[model samples]
Target: MYFTIRPARPADVHGILTADIAAGRTSPADAERFAAGISAAVADPARLVVVAEAHDDANAEGGTGVVGWAKTHHWDYADGPAPAGHYLGGVTVRPEFRRKGLAAQLTEARLHWMWERVEFAWYVVNAHNEASLALHRRWGFREVARGARFHTVAFDGGEGVLLSAARPQA
Candidate 1:
């Protein structure tokens, strides 16, 4: 699909919510809460939220709409194996758009943003998510530790793998 990645705007919140709903993450009734959360992130200087907009071949410069989104969250841990830094957040895309490398592209964009401010990028994933683990490995992420919980987040699968990738010099 022809698309471009860019920082999300307030108007993109609805499209992002649509994606989340399509992924079965939430219901349409929760749009207000979702929009508020996204709005806060967009307004925060310490956090980064980006979207991938699909474009028609004939109108590549003007997007058709937001097809996917990814974000990062800053976590300050007073005491934990997970250090205080910006952590990789989740990526969501329309179901029809899965397995097309859109996730990788979104991840690369987040890493690029992270690398500009930190020496290492951190991510915590469920141990059972082999696909995500495999995808991240291609970006140089390696296991730092494994636990039932990291910082304040707990894995639904009961075990989470904490991984980090050093910033590659540009």
Candidate 2:
């Protein structure tokens, strides 16, 4: 359960990809496309890909491995005209690591990154995901709008709420 949060590296792509697929967030066929996208993000200085790496006592190399990950980047809302801002996307923690506050740690890291670059942070969550909704609200995000804004998209087919939170002042 001991882990450290750090910026993701190119080598962590497979661990991230495996976690995403295991979480049912993406399919196996999407591996190639996801790898390319992840590679680009890792290389982009403006973007961030953070991962929670757990210490591996069983490994002889004495190195840690990624167990959770979250990324921040610009997302253009296509439903209607809206200001583009930093989007908190792809937040995930492995199943065994759930309820251990890894998600919050990942989110806090993303928010900290946001406060340095933007006035606001945007994210979309499935309406039925009460846990995620509660987490966002607890972190000060308020729903700006909901319904078909994310249509034809992943997970819930665009049936979700659009939420935003002001960047915390330093």
Candidate 3:
């Protein structure tokens, strides 16, 4: 499906919350809190939040055109293999839009934003998340460490792998 990947806006917060809820990443009861958090991220000067807005024609399900979202954040882990630097924080795509390159596009947008100021990027993933791992590998992210947690970021019932990749040159 066609989508427009761009920097997120205040109006996009609810769409993001919708995506989060649909992906089972957020509970309906916590929607207000989640929306507030998304607002904060949208307003944060130090964070890069991007969203994939589905084209009107592509959103055949009559849902919000916001089909996916992603963000990059500065991580400072005092006790893990990951150092204080920019990281590819996370992404979420609506179920109907999954496996359609939306995730990669969102990731590319964030990486592009980061590469403007840094030479490297980092990310962490659950060891059991083979799909994400494979995607990161394709982006040239190599393993740096593995453990139950990366400082305060804990993996759910599995090991977490810290990965890093250099900025791609044009």
Candidate 4:
């Protein structure tokens, strides 16, 4: 299965937003805001947003589009582990696209992009998200801390654990 993975463009926003909602990540309203944010990040070199566009099927680029996406924050010292730390979240794949290795491919691409410049990369996952926890583990991320997620659109009083890994070279 071949896919053209690259930083997202504004034209891909609508499709990406649709997949995000279908993946149960956000409501239509939230998807709109999320798309805007992702577009902005993709335009900024310091930030990262990778999308996987399937190439084999005729309906590949439309309808059930944008198989998956990975968003990484630029160095945010206050919200991260170090001065040059990066944080990733909102990693999602369409329900039909799950278990297809799309998420892992997107994740590796994003991590490779940041490894050259960042000291560490980290993400927080809901404790109950077994798939995500397993994925992170496979990618070499380890649990470092835990904290309450004070706000969430899906759940009330949810808590998540911080998982981090040093760049392979470092």
Model 1, 50-102: lDDT tens digits are: 99888777877777678889999898762378888988988898887787788
Model 2 over residues 54-76: C-alpha lDDT tens digits?
76567635445678899987755
Write down the TM-score of every candidate.
0.93, 0.85, 0.90, 0.82
Each prediction's Cα lDDT score? Answer: 0.87, 0.79, 0.85, 0.74
Residue 99 local lDDT, model 4: 81
TM-score of candidate 2 to 2 decimals = 0.85
lDDT by residue (tens digit), candidate 3, 126-151: 99999899877777999999988875
Tell me the tens digit of each residue's lDDT in model 4 across 17-101. Answer: 8878888887986766787787888788887888887766666565345878878875544443223357775688888777878
- Tell me, by lDDT, which candidate is best: 1
Model 3 RMSD in Å is 2.6
For model 1, the superposed segments whose C-alpha errors exceed 4 Å read none
Per-candidate count of clashing residue pairs (backbone under 3 Å): 0, 2, 0, 0
Ranking the candidates on TM-score from highest down gives 1, 3, 2, 4
lDDT measured at residue 88 in model 1 versus the true structure, 0 to 100: 91
Candidate 1 pairs with clashing backbones: none
